[model samples]
Target chain A: MNLQVVYCNHQTAELDIRERLAFATSDQLSNAYEYLRSHFPQTELVLLSTCNRVELYTAQESQDDAPSHQDIAHFFSDFHEIPLTDFFDDLLERTGPDAVRHLFQVVSSVDSMVLGEPQIVSQVKEAYRTATEYEACGPLTHALFQGAIRVSSRVRTETGLTEGRVSIASVAVGEFGKSIFDRFDDKTVLVIGAGEMAEETLRYLSNEGVRRINIVNRSPDRARALAERWPGAQVHAYEKLEELLVGADVIVSTTGSEKPIVSVGQFSRIRRNHLDKPVFILDLGAPRDFEPGIGQIDDGVFLYDIDDLETTCEQNRIARGTEVERALEIIDDETDRFMREIYHRATGPIVKRLREQWHDISQTEVRSLKSKLGHLGNDDLKAIERSMERLVNKLLHPPLEALKDEAREGTPHGLLDALKRLFHIKD
Target chain B: MVNVNVICFLASYSVVLIMELMRLLGRSPVRRTIMLLFGTAGFAAHTLYLMNRSNQANLPPLLSSSHDWLLVLAWISILMYLFLTTIDRNLAIGLFVIPLVLFLIAAAYFVSDSSMPVLNVSNLRDAQQAALRRWVMLHASLLVFGIAGVIVGLVLSLMYLVQHRRLKHKQTMQRGLRLPSLAVLSRWNWWAVIISVPLLTLGLATGFGVAFLSDEAVPVSMADPVIMIYGVAWAVMAAFFAWLLTTRRPAGKQVAWMTIWAFGFLLVTLVGLQVLAGSGLDSFHAGGTRDSSGLV
Candidate 1:
């Protein structure tokens, strides 16, 4: 059995290259799998594409028929309509044990941008499920993926990497919100857009003792739904944002707009009304909800965006480097152990057929001897048969033991061929 | 069974503070164990010290000398710190409480050692003497509790600033220094202010009653610097309390910062004036008559 992976990750490629090469949606992944099956009919494939990395794992029973890195790169070129020269150098390849270990690391989140994030494991599971739905996975791919998930579970259970400050929101609130305010219970929390990020931030704030919560969204139903979920929270129309700003101590904005929702002039006018009371604004929107210049309005107002959180998250990631090393070592050891077990299973049929052939010849000889010695006493005849059978068993033990021991390293293909010739065993 | 001294507990708390600092680097079970051991040891010694002082003075710690009185305040803070830290080992409350403990202990060194004179007269009314003693005890108790509230408010404010800074800088919470959420801290700060102002008002009222009772014989003046300083501290606290009660629109952070400044000023003035009085720098002690038996 041969297992291989052709991939590009944060370490090997820039974000732009990864984005360009990524299978962005489930539909895209299904199309990629169809193309892979057409091009390499004998191989089993699973495609895992996430924001941080894009990996293609393939396994086949015949080593000679395994797809090359160039063939996979051409698949990407053909499917995405991007020339192979554009990103061929950025792609990396690993085969055999290394491929297995890489999948383990990816599933365990050791290779994630956020070292111990829980999202990558789910992403890997989804990718495998998608591949299975497309009939792209066989026995080898199934075993490999299952082993990777189990290893990931073991790593999480054994390590303290996920013990504290695990979420981006927790870090943001702990690092920035506490620094800006002396207390939270009395603070007015203004949530803009009522998105998931807004809810996450609000939950953290609510635990901090925020008594008043104001949720503003363009959709009144969304605002009311969010407000209804949290006690002491009030829903307001989007137009009341300026009025809410006048009383708000902390502002969390997460909208799905393509442009900044709050301009500099609008925020400055609100700031003038709020005066010396410090306001902490967390802009989690992709296109930036509040104008960047609002951060420069006054010292009293503290603003943070997604990129600002990266530096601190990176520092935390660095701190867990030792844990990452430990997780990787475990993955490496498990991969080797698993591969050895797989190789041992592969040698089972040949060993069984050889033993059956030897036993059959011994049985035929014993029956003939018994028939010829019919006049002898029953005990004497039985003793002779037993002695002959013991001789046959002893002779068979050594070769089988050697073959079993050799399978530990790999398939032992050369040793198996030699055994077939020496024993005159037929296919 | 070795006898523990104030120095022993003081040293223990100091070590605990160091452990708290070490926790900022990384989480360690050994460090946590050592911190708990030292904290518990310090609390035991602190209890013994207060008991010893109370027994020696033949009065409750609050009614004892100012030195014992200050020690009682420190004891309350330590109790709070121990309770909080015990429940949540991850909280870095020692960093906030330890410095306050050290300050209180240091201030205890400069406070007057002489006890409040217990006036005893056979011919005078027994009911009046009992009332006077009760009033004095009430006055001392109210002030201690009020001052304890101030300490809590100040600590919460400090925690708020630290938490805010971490959030603004986008720094993650260190493993061992986790603080209460902003909402919780703010609520506690509000409670601290609300509870403290009433206690302080009662303390001031009882003090005035004691002064009025003494005016018949002692020519006590309200313009005394100690009285004036205390009056100013009371006024500042009262103003803050009024603002808190009346202003429905103040932000929690605004209130937290205001509480910090207000409580900070009160603490400095109250401790400063006491130290000044003990140092014999004020006009009240300039006479050098050594009438340490005066009621006011």
Candidate 2:
């Protein structure tokens, strides 16, 4: 048997190439699976396509029949309508153990651009499911994907790789926003400006059951666009910032202004009546839309700018980095276990036939001896049969032991062939 | 019966507290499980010790003596701690809770382990003893439960302060010491103060009732130093409770501080007076027929 993977990822290819090569939708992936199945009739295939990587894994029962690197490269060229020269150098290939290890790392998220990310596992699962739906998966791909899923689980629970939030928006909303409020469904979320960071923070808050969202921007069009994405969100005029701030339980500011938008003097005047109410402020702007001193005004205001989150994100990154070695060790151990199983699988049939041929020959000879000797007693015949069996086992033990040992490193194709020829075995 | 003593559980609790402190360095599931194992073993030993005392005196642990009362309070706190930590492995509640439990157990060491004098029904006629026993049970039970509430309030207040400081500084939560959200902590703290003050007040009222009832049978004086100190502590707690209820909207940090002061003062005063009473200071509540077991 043979295993191979030809792919390009964030590390090997630019975004331009990855995007062009990606099967962006299920329909596209189905079409690609159909095309690959028609071209390579004897191979099993699973295609894993995400924003950061595009990998095609194939397995075959015979090494001679497996598609070569050039064949897969040509398939990508013909299927995606891109010339082979455009990405031939960018497309990398791995065979056997390297192929298995690559899939394990990808499924475990060790190969993600954002290290310790959780999405790649689900992406790989979806790819495998799609391959199964298309009937492109056989025993080899099934075992490979199942083993990859198990390895991902082991890496996640055994290591602290996914323990902390590393992104600014995630840290701001997940760590700080959640610590201040018990629940967000009743709290008013105020977005000061329609920046990308604001939208991202809103996404996290929305997931946390936030229902009431108020978007205020100097530009009405941008604010409306932001408000339209959420079902219950409303766009407010920039003039109503102070009124909104008083009502908001959570405030996220990500304006592009060069200086502070809400000054201490202005906020203190507004915060006079709401001193007891807690407000989580995420000032994602570079210059900080909310003044720094407002945080010190009262215990109710939790103001965190980009620098604060960067420190947390950096710490989380370092923590995740430390777990990478442990994760790789797990992956390597799983990879070796998987290769060992596949190699032993290849030697199974030959070993079974060799043993069966020798035992059948011994049984037939023992029966012939009993029939030829008319004076032979029942005990004598039984003793002769036991001796014949022991002789056959003694003769077959050495080569069988060598075959078992050779199977540990990989499939011993040459030795299997020599055994078949020597024993006059068929198939 | 198995011989159980205060040292058995005290040593167990001390080890559990140290293990909880180790979480400041890093989180490990194995460490957490081990901490819980120690905490559970301590709670079991505490239960056995209390049962032995109750068996020796032939009374409930609460009504037996000051030492038994303090141990009952610690037992309740450890029960709460084990329940909370078991349900949520991430809560660093033990860091705030276990030390207070240890303090209560240690306070048991310095207080009188002999049964309360007013509860000594052995000398009275059977009819009068029955009547006195009911009054003492009410007084001791009310006081034990009320003190447990105060301990809970103190732990909640300390947790609120730590969580508030972490949020105010924008520091990431330690992985092992995950606390409740500030809103949840504040809400629970408010309830703790609200519920505990009323209980403590009723407990004081019941104490006065017991003293008045016992005047004819035994000269249970109202001017005992322990009683005087308890009355003063109750007064402080009542004032804080009133402020907490009547104020329009108090800051969370301010409430946390007030709870800490109110509850902290009451605990210290109660434990201090008991220690003084055990040292042979003049108090009707302390001295009685001492049990020979020395299990408290």
Candidate 3:
């Protein structure tokens, strides 16, 4: 049995390179599968495409026909209309046991951009289902994907890998925002900047059912563009910040300012319009756009800076680190077990043939002995037959034991061939 | 039948408090369940003890004696604590509220355990006794409810300050130690102080009103130093409550600290007066000695 994986992830390649290599949708993946079938018809494949990773896993019955690193890399180039030399260096290759271990790590979230994230397992599961839908997977890929999912579950159960909020946006919204407000849909979410970080956080908040999102930035065009991405979002001018502040229930600020933009006095004046209403201010800016004293101004104001989320993120990262080591240990054990099973399966036919051939020889000897000892008692004849069977087993024990031992590391192809010639075995 | 006492329930509440402290380190449903169990057991024993006191004294727990009255207040606080805790699973309210319950119960030990002379058959027949009992009931009920408000205000302010500190300082929440939002706590604190101060003032005013309506034979004095001290405490609280309500842009930290100081003084003054007056054996809150008391 031959298995292989060729992939690039957050660690091996940049985001642009991965995006260029990724299959964006199911149709793309399906077309890629059709292309793969035409090129390497003997191989079974599963394609895993996520924001951070693009991996192709393949398995083949015949080792000789297994797709090589260059072949799969060229397939990607031809399919995407990209030159091979552009990303060939970024593309990595793993085969046999390493490939299996890689898949296990990926599924377990040890290979993710955010270590110990729980999304990768579902991504892999979806990929496997898609492969099955496209008829790209077989028994080997099925067993592998199933085993990887099981390992992911075991890792989640046995470890603290998936415990805390891992991402900055997730930590901000989940750990801080949920604590501030019991519900989000009723609250007005004022996103104070239109940068990528702001957009990312807005995505998290929007997912929390934030119905009213007002994007306010120094640049109105950028604000409008950002607001257009989230559902039911409205864009406002930067000068209307105070009006929006009084109106908003939640504020997410991701301005890249060097100094404080909102002062304590400025907020104090803004708060006069809405004294009792609680406002959650997320200061995700570097050097903090909102002054620290603004949080101190009133009980209705709950202001959080990036440092708050970092502490939580750091603790989560540490927790995930310990779980990662544990997950790796589980992966190692599973990979070894999978390889051993495959090797043991490869040794099956040879062991069966050898056993059958020896049993035939023993039966023939027993028949001859029985014919020669026709005058002997029936009980004596049976005892003599048992002795002949024991003799044949003893004679065949050493070579069969050697063959079984050789199959532990991998399929004992050389030993099986030698045994077939020495025993006059066919097929 | 097993007899339950103050110590029985006080010990139970202490266990609940310890479990609440343990919850600050991390969340454990088992710990919360055990705390609830201890709280329920304690509240049950507390209820039985109050009933026993009332039975022995032939009066309600609030009118029996200062000791019983304080226990009744604690009992009310415990009920609130348990009810709030039952409703909000993630709230670390017990940590903030149980210490007050324990304080009231502990202070009961230092105060008078004596039942008043109002429970006597002879006093029950006296016309003056009926008038005095109404006044005393009004006085005690107003004080109990007012002090309940004070306890709530103090707790809400403390919660507000804690939540404010966590938010302003940008600290991640401690596992299992989550308070309500600052807005909720501040609003609750505002209402608590607003409603409770009036109840307390009415209690003090009624104390004087009762004294004025009584005949000279009762030997009660409105001008007594203890009563004057209570008047002073009431005035101080009245001023603080006025400042709290009138101020439009009260800073959260400022409000939290003021509530702490003002409510802290009110509680200390109220409890100190009871302890001191009860020690002297002649104050209105203390009507009889432990030797003359049926409930003790």
Candidate 4:
């Protein structure tokens, strides 16, 4: 089995590079799958494209069909219409056990900018689901992603990595929102989208004691649904967005719109009444629901996009470096356990056949000896058969131990081939 | 049993403060537990020392002397600290509350540990002195609880400002300096100001009542400059307390700032008076105080 990953993350590349390279939508991802299939038909792929990183994981049954780092890079270059040289230095590659470990680390959030964030796990799960939907994933990729998610849970349970501030909502509110306002109970929290992200940010806000919540969306039913989950949260029509925006002390917009929903002119008008009163705006949208210029509308307008929070996230990462180390330790252990299982799966058929072949030969020899020594006492024949069985078991132990040991690092392909030829074992 | 002096409990509080500072570097359950243990041990030693002092002086800790009075204040503050910490280990109330405790214990050293003038009220008739002593106890008791409220207000205000600054700056809650929510702290601070200022007023009124009740031999008169200074400090607090109640829309930051000033002035005046009166620099109080250290 061959496993490989090519990726560019926040640590390796800037946001612009990642955003350009990301498969932003399901349609785009499905198209990427089509392109990948045409290029590496024998390979299984799982592409994870988030705002922070764009990663492509591939696995193959035959080593010959395993695409090189350069091939994946070329695919990114060609699909995005950017030259390979433009991002070749930024693209990183991991193969075999290293690839397996990387996915585990990513899923566990040890590799995330925010060390213990839970969003990465869901993002990875969603990526895997998309891959399966497009028929891009096979047994190898399926097993890899599934193991990655399972290890993610272990890392969370065994380590303190997931203890505090584990989401963008918590980080934004706990870090920025708390800093901006003296108290949340008196503040107005306006959520502009009725999506999961909006609900998540609201959860953090409510935890901080924000009572007056105004959830406005294009769909009134969606807004009502989200409002119902939290008490004291009011639903408003999308037309009343400006009124809600002006009233909100802390505004978190996560609309799934493609372009900027709030332009500088629109927010400038909203700020007429709230010039001195500070407004903390968290634009968690991918394409950005609010224009970047809205951040500079005034000194009172404290605007933060997802990328703006990287510095705060990095500080959180350093603060919890020990938790990261402990989480990584679990990930490493789980990775090895997973790799050993895959290796055992590969070597199981051959090992079973070899054991059956040797046992059959021992039985035949015992039978023939029993017949030849028919003149001897029956007890003597039985004793001789037991001794022959022990002799065969002793002979098989060394090679079998060697095969098991070799399977630790990887499939013992060379040793298995030699054993098959030497023992007349057929698979 | 060995004697546990003020220094013993003071040292314990110092160690708790140091450990609280260390908690700011990172969150550690062991560190928090160790700090609380030291705090508890310190409180035990403090209790022992106060009981010893009160027994030796033949008075309650509050009525014993200026030194014991300060320790009593620190003791109640520590009690509140322990209760808050027990409820929420993450509440970092100690980071704000413990320094005041340490200061009170240390300040006890500078003030006179001698028995109050009422203790040495030998010149007055036995019945008159006895009545004066009861009034003095009521005065100190009211002041101890009331001043506890002042210190609480001051701590709450500081917490409010720090929490506000962190929230405004968009910084993570500094590692272990977690405080109560602003709403809770503000409400507590408001109550601290409102409740404490009145208790302090009644305490002052009782002190004046003692003046009128006692004869000239003890020399506790309302005309004294020390009494006048306390009256002025009371006015400062009263004015702020009134505003806190009347303000239609009280901004937490504004209220917190004014509370810091009002409570801060009250503490300084109270301690300044004790220090001055302890030194026998012509400062005024009830009867005649004998400096146990005989420093004068």
TM-score of each: 0.58, 0.89, 0.64, 0.60
Error of 3 at B129 (Å): 5.1
Q: Residue by residue across A117-234, what tens digits does model 2's lDDT show?
A: 9999899999999999999999899999999999999998777777789999888887888888889999999999998999988999999999999999999999999999999999
Interface RMSD of 1: 4.8
How far is A325's C-alpha from truth in model 4 (Å)?
Answer: 3.9
Q: iRMS of every model, one decimal?
A: 4.8, 1.4, 4.3, 4.9
DockQ, every prediction: 0.18, 0.60, 0.16, 0.11
DockQ score, prediction 3: 0.16
- Name the weakest run of 10 consecutive residues (lDDT summed) in model 4 chain A: A158-167
lDDT of 3 by residue, B50-136 (tens): 898888777878888888888888999999999999998778899888999999988887777766543333524467677777887
Quality of candidate 2 docking, DockQ: 0.60
How should the candidates be ordered by DockQ, best one leading? 2, 1, 3, 4
What CA RMSD would you report for each candidate? 11.7, 3.5, 9.5, 11.5
TM-score of chain B of each: 0.89, 0.95, 0.92, 0.93
Docking class of 3: incorrect
Off by over 4 Å in 2: A340-404, A411-427, B1-8, B125-138, B212-217, B287-296
lDDT (tens digit, per residue) of candidate 1 on A1-427: 7889999999999998899999998789878888899889999999999999989999997877789999889988889899898899999999888898889988988888767888898999999999999999999999999898899888876554554444567756766677556578878888988888888888888888988998889998988988988999998878888888888888888888899988889989888856657788888899888889888786567888877766666666666765776677778889988898778767877888887887788789878877886787878877877887788889988988898888877778788889889888776
Candidate numbers, best TM-score first, in rank order: 2, 3, 4, 1
lDDT of each: 0.81, 0.88, 0.83, 0.82
All candidates in order of lDDT, best leading:
2, 3, 4, 1
Error of 4 at A190 (Å): 2.4
Greater DockQ among 3 and 4 belongs to 3
